[model samples]
Target chain A: MKRKYFQRKFDIRTYECDFKGQLHPLALFNFMQELASTHADRLGFSVQKLMQQKMTWVLSRLHLKINKPLRWGETLTGRTWPSGRVGKYALRDFQFFNQTGETTAVGTSSWMVIDLEKRQPLKLDQLFTSDVSLKKRALADDFPALPEIDNSENQCKFAVRFSDLDLNRHVNPVSYIAWALESLPEPVLFRHYPMEVEVSYRKEVFLGDQVICKLQQIQGTESLSYIHKLFLEKNGQEIARLRTLWK
Target chain B: MKRKYFQRKFDIRTYECDFKGQLHPLALFNFMQELASTHADRLGFSVQKLMQQKMTWVLSRLHLKINKPLRWGETLTGRTWPSGRVGKYALRDFQFFNQTGETTAVGTSSWMVIDLEKRQPLKLDQLFTSDVSLKKRALADDFPALPEIDNSENQCKFAVRFSDLDLNRHVNPVSYIAWALESLPEPVLFRHYPMEVEVSYRKEVFLGDQVICKLQQIQGTESLSYIHKLFLEKNGQEIARLRTLWK
Candidate 1:
């Protein structure tokens, strides 16, 4: 029997909306941070306490899906649990609920514990001796698949802007999503919601450089999937390739 | 001599940071949106066009700031200019710059040609005008005086979680500046700074808020001339208040 880990709840604020008055995709990422931090706190590990121990949690990969739009002023609850441990990695699952107890969105994230001094990955087993019991739930099997990179025709370009960066002084992964999505028209982009997303960063983007974002769409009968590529450009020199999957 | 309407230059991404690696201040605001949009198009009459039609912009006002920080990826420039004319409301000032001269934030705002909308004590003439060749410069002032509120200590209780409600489904206005200056210990709250700020709302904020921020001391004495506030909360509240002056 799998042990059940503690669940945490968080409220929604108005400051998380876009021009359309709905929560922006990037804002959802921040909510995930809060949910995860709260869960850690209940489990004898908090971000603040970890920092005191010179340790941090770095997000290696994230796959998310938004089934419904969250509106402003609506009180929403976010619940999270750790699924399992794999070598040096930990898989966590999240579910967002509305005031009515209906699920609005679901997310799964892969994280690595790191030693603050060495910045090296640490194993989950080394951190916790017993399994943090979370309600036994099946892992999401509907995550979007990774995109295939074809060095041909699908070309997208973007300039790395200061706003695209984050506290790590590195280009925020979300900015890549914005760039990739912005390539589409406003009407189409706004009308069709993001049901699933998968992104992989090939290299880091730096300051004062122009970036190129490329995309290719794979059409399906009922849904569609896209592959995105991001590159740093200076006089046509390629810097990096970022591949993303969106449906 | 050329007249200056508004003068402020800041690195693009630097404007968006806190202690953590999240987008520090809320990104969607009417003022910031207008600045971004106008900056992208570079059209002198966009604001005028909107006003001439007697259609004004109204936002729900959602401002939130976070303790998570933003990193540096590329060079960003933020600029504000005047979008000329709307009947008695002549000079509409806007600020927006891009990561690489491309607008990332943009919007269209409404200024009352007549104060009839709010039924407040002020009138249109007391606000603005369109004598383009006049010697009056809008940018002359570095910081506008804080609007004198009824400053009752009883009315000024330290904002707690419940009071942090997003009445408009967005973060409350009172909390905007508070979060931006969170990094400063209580000793710095009362200190004065030479800073200029203008925040126009696009949405609202709601409960269970957590804000974290810091102070960026510019040139001059460190005796209190620089202050900032960021509402970096999880539930939905995020706002930013920035102040800078010669110490």
Candidate 2:
């Protein structure tokens, strides 16, 4: 039988909030990631252990649906478990709730095991075993193909610094999201609640690597929804595409 | 009689470490700040409550001496209490210790309660009532005036983004430190450990405001050290002046 999901609890801090006194999406993602890593460590598959073997986990995509608002000083519990592998991707799911057991949000992510030396993907089928049965259900209705905007505007250039590097010694995903969001104007930032987020991490960004974020804003089929496409300036490489729905 | 010191414990996370696997100076400072804030809140002078009165705590200067290396999963307890007031500055002190009761580092800070609406400082004499009796102990040996470098090199410009804004809607000190450190070359970053840090915050920066970081390398009488100055690009208004001693 599969073991119970790993759970961790924390109270949000003041600095984690934005101008509106609301919890930031970046902070939410970080809480889930911390729980995931801690859970993996208990299972003897921690990031540090993986790094020693020259294998690291790289996130490919994440989908989150927020059902409630999280604010400062609220005690919340984050629970996560490895659902199963979807083809070449290792899948994991997360759920957050308040003290009253009310669900706040749910998230699902896909990660790939990368051999650091070879810089290539490693198959998970033969590499590991788990007691939890892989859930066949997809996280979202569909993972849509982001729009291809030929013409775009370069928002800004971000230089990866020491604080941006994670245990794996590369630019972390939260930093990528922050850089992409910086490309938008202030009005777009404060206007809406992010209903859904999609990310496809293309390549590993390292220290001293210069990354220029280019953004192309498009209208979503639903009224008032906005879509932003992020790309690398030098090679025209697509980093990650994001979409947000307003209330 | 004085109240006992407020203490909080936390395990350093992997992301909070730098490339060398040691805890980042920024992260260490943040931990202390968190402890101070929580203490203030327990004393009924929390940032939120102060903001409601059109006042907020502003960090003026901080001096910390690192005697230990904090790594991922290492639990450290932060203890803080009111030391005393030096003229217009209310003094607070912090000391960190490991699980074995070994002292890791000590920190002292000066803070000002600012009238956010009037953009002025208010005397702390009548503002706060803490059970902890103020002990007359200077945080540092000498709070020296930063070098007035007539001619310095402008390193780079950092535009204040949403990520830089804290709960008070101002550019946080951590962001300021990051910008200042960015002025230094990589060789300086990895070669030495930061022994002493002194900062003088001059003016407030907001979102969309682009600040320029300037650096001037100087030889210290004791050993090796560096000084960095930051300012506004357009007005040339000073933001912060920093000094770091290396071992």
Best by lDDT: 2
Candidate 1 falls in which docking quality class?
incorrect
Minimal lDDT window, size 10, model 2 chain A: A133-142
Please give the C-alpha DockQ score of model 1.
0.08
Give the TM-scores of the predictions, in the order they appear: 0.53, 0.92
lDDT of 1 by residue, A4-81 (tens): 444444433334455445666666766666567656766767755677777867666676778787865576777778
Q: Measured with DockQ on alpha carbons, how good is candidate 2?
A: 0.57
In the range B118-198, model 1's lDDT, one tens digit per residue, is 523233344334343233322332223322212211111122333233323334453454444333333332232213333
Highest DockQ among the candidates is held by which one? 2
Query: Cα RMSDs of all predictions?
Result: 16.4, 2.6
Error of 1 at B73 (Å): 27
The list of candidate 1 runs beyond 4 A from truth reads A1-15, A116-119, A133-145, A151-173, A185-187, A201-210, A234-247, B1-17, B20-54, B58-247
Model 2, runs deviating above 4 Å: A1-4, A129-144, A150-154, A217-224, B1-4, B128-132, B136-142, B150-154, B220-223
The Cα error of candidate 1 at residue A171, in Å, is: 4.3
